[model samples]
Target: MSDAVQASGAPAPVGHYPHARRVGQLLFLSGIGPRDPASNAIVGNVHDADGHLISYDIDAQCRAVFANVRAVLQASGARWEDLVDVTVYLTDMARDFKAYNRVWAECFPDASRAPCRTTLGINALPTPIAIELKCVAEIKSPLPLAGEG
Candidate 1:
């Protein structure tokens, strides 16, 4: 049976779903954004007087989103090196791609160790965040249930 993972250290999911799900050796993470866990605030977002998004810092968002992904991976008993694939979504590809790529290289410094990635330019997200990541990891060990050690 598959198990759902809810990371207490990560922001609560925007919808009813858990942060991730594990089926066999694979852990699939939901779309992870740059929302802070304690405040639920969008990182790097610059809003206008009426709270509309004016701009964002893609580098900060990328770091935060990667941190969120790491939290989900840890909660699922996986590791950063276990990530097999990642799908990135950006609201403004033309403006953010270079900064995003720079942060990505920092996170995955070694080309041989980096996960397979696909980045897409999207119109919007559930929130005003500029970027999000969907990730898949190969778990080397079985994840314990909520009650068991």
Candidate 2:
């Protein structure tokens, strides 16, 4: 049954797809954008890249994106505290970079102990949402090592 979902507390996948997957003691999560998992769409279109679409608000997107990430962690039995490393991708650095770090600090427990992170700007992404986060986490479990006899 555990192989089925022992880690889950009968939690559903964030979508038809999983927000995260656990192999051994590691969890790999997809980017959590600013959207309610139930809704599957960002509250509104985010026009982040060079004013491509219409909206260009960074704060709102950061909040929502982080929230989505939380949901994923919960579903996978991991948490921000469990995170070992994170990768963030964005489109515009000048306009949103400073604000992004500020939001991240507010969203997490402490920056000093925060997971190793990388932030970079790209020309394009799946949506206009200003920030996307992917995480890797470790959950301690008792299992025999391959070399164990």
Which tens-of-lDDT digit does each residue in 1-149 have in candidate 1?
69899999899999999999999899999999999998999999899999888888888899999999988898889999999999999998999999999999998899899999999999999988999999999999887766975
Inter-residue clash pairs, candidate 1: none
Give all TM-scores, in the order shown. Answer: 0.95, 0.74
Q: What is the overall TM-score of model 2 with all chains considered together?
A: 0.74
Deviation in Å, model 1, residue 11 alpha carbon? 0.5
Model 2 clashing residue pairs (backbone): none
Task: Kindly list the per-residue Cα lDDT of model 2 for residues 12-109, writing each as its tens digit.
Answer: 34446655667878878766667655555665565557955676567877887777666666656566688889898887888889989898888676
lDDT winner = 1
Give the Cα lDDT of each candidate. 0.92, 0.68
